[model samples]
Target: MIKAQGLRKTFTTRSRKGTQTVEAVRGVDLQVGKGEIFGVLGPNGAGKTTTIRMLATLIAPDAGQAVIADHDLLKEPAAVRRKLGYVSQAGGVEDIMSARAQIMMAARIHGVADPKRAADDVLKRFDLTEMADRPGRTLSGGQKRRVSIALGLVHDPPLLFLDEPTTGLDPQNRANLWDRIKQLRESGTSVLLSTHYLDEADVLCDRLVIVDHGQIVAEGTPAELKRGVSGDVITLRVDGLETAAETLKPFAREIRVDEDVLRVYVDDGEHTLPALLRTLEERGIRLSSIALDRCTLDDVFLAHTGRSLRDTGADA
Candidate 1:
């Protein structure tokens, strides 16, 4: 439903030093298929929002070509807007307006044939019928979020843009929202999502692109990206970390040292553990803790960007 190439955006900020250009998004390319949830995963400052804004017609890219929902993004923005729904990062609903009223107004603005009925159906779909009459300010964060999504979906546009959909919700609410997003895909609404959460990208996205420093570093399905990082992850909490990592390099496919632990990637953790421990013992390394698990998105991010998403994103 969306295809973009060579998308770039820059901002000029005035400071004491003088005007400086900040390349917020540089050369981002994207392809989102119909009836699928495609994710743009990255850290806070990795241009995820900037890229989404460019595609949503809220901001024009400095240099790029994009077509969304079969309409040229730059040339046919109004037609593109008519076919898509955008829920910004800070989802908005008037504090004094009830959820039902807000959604109905949105539907009317979008020129839905039956605004009231459309709003009601969307409220029911998002399980917000019970509190539909409550003011936005009175609702919980999760409830407000649901209401915002319902408002965006009331017109039933073919495509949806969600920026950081579940950033602050609790686990239960997050899962609830996940089900709703899945239902949208099942019912054939193409979705474009942006998130920094590793697990969200892994569980929700059919395919994703990992962005860093204003550029896409890797792109693939979650499993494909994880599989690209060879071997299992063996994390060790040990003293004398630097020496131990260097000594175990021969047995490890890759090694990354965090603040309090060393994450070692090895072909076979079961067989490698004994030999690794012996080497540490012989080298007088003091072991505090150890864990072995399959490689995850963090490992993938590390492989591609030389940094862990766990350190940068708001992890669960």
Candidate 2:
């Protein structure tokens, strides 16, 4: 339902020194299949939101081209907007408006055939029926978020752009939203989601691209991406982490040290553990604890970016 090629955007900011150019997005290419939930997975400042903005027609790209629902993104932006719904990072709802009022207003703006009926249906779909009369300011963060998404669905667009949809929701609310997103896909609504949460991408996305520093480093299903990292992860708690890192470097496909712990990624953790232990004993290093687990999306991020996803900054 969406295709983008070499989409690029740059922003110039004024500072005390002078104006500085920031490449918020660089040659970002994406494709979201009809009825698929595609994800743009990245840490903050990785251009996920910027890419979404360009696709949603909220911002124009400095270069490249895109098509949304068969409409030209540059030449037919209004048509593209008519075919898609956008729920931004903040969920942008009026705090003083009641949930019913907010959704009905959006319905009217979208020219829904029956604005009141559309608003009522959306409220019930999002399980906000009981809170329909409550003002946005009176709702909890999760309830307000639901209302925001309800507003987006008032138009019944074929595609939805959800940028950090679960950013500030509690675990329960996040999970609930996941269910709602899944239902959307089942009902044939193409969803393009941008999120930094590894678990969210793992569980929610049918396919995803891992973006970093304004570029795509990897793209695939969560399992396919994790498989790129090679084998199990063995975390060892030991003294002299630096020395242990170097000592086990040859046996490990990859090694990272955090304080007194060493995380070793290798092809065969069970076979390598005995050899590692023997080597440590020979070097007179004390081992405190050791554990093995399957590779995770974070490991995939580390392998591709050379840094943990959680370490990225908040701005792109």
lDDT of 1 by residue, 1-316 (tens): 9999999999999989899998999999999998999999988999999999999999999999999999999999999999999998789878999999999999999999999999989998988999999888999888888888887888888999999989889999898889888999999999999998888988999999999989999999998887788668999999888988899999988888877789998878899999999999998999999999988888888888777787775473
- How does candidate 1 score on lDDT? 0.90
- Quote the RMSD, in angstroms, for model 1: 1.6
| Candidate 1 error regions (>4 Å) | none
- Residue-level lDDT of model 2, residues 72-131, one tens digit each, is 999999999989999998998888889999899898888899999999898889999998
What is the alpha-carbon lDDT for the whole of candidate 2? Answer: 0.90
lDDT (Cα, 0-100) at 203 in candidate 2: 95
**How far off is residue 175 in model 1, in Å?**
1.6
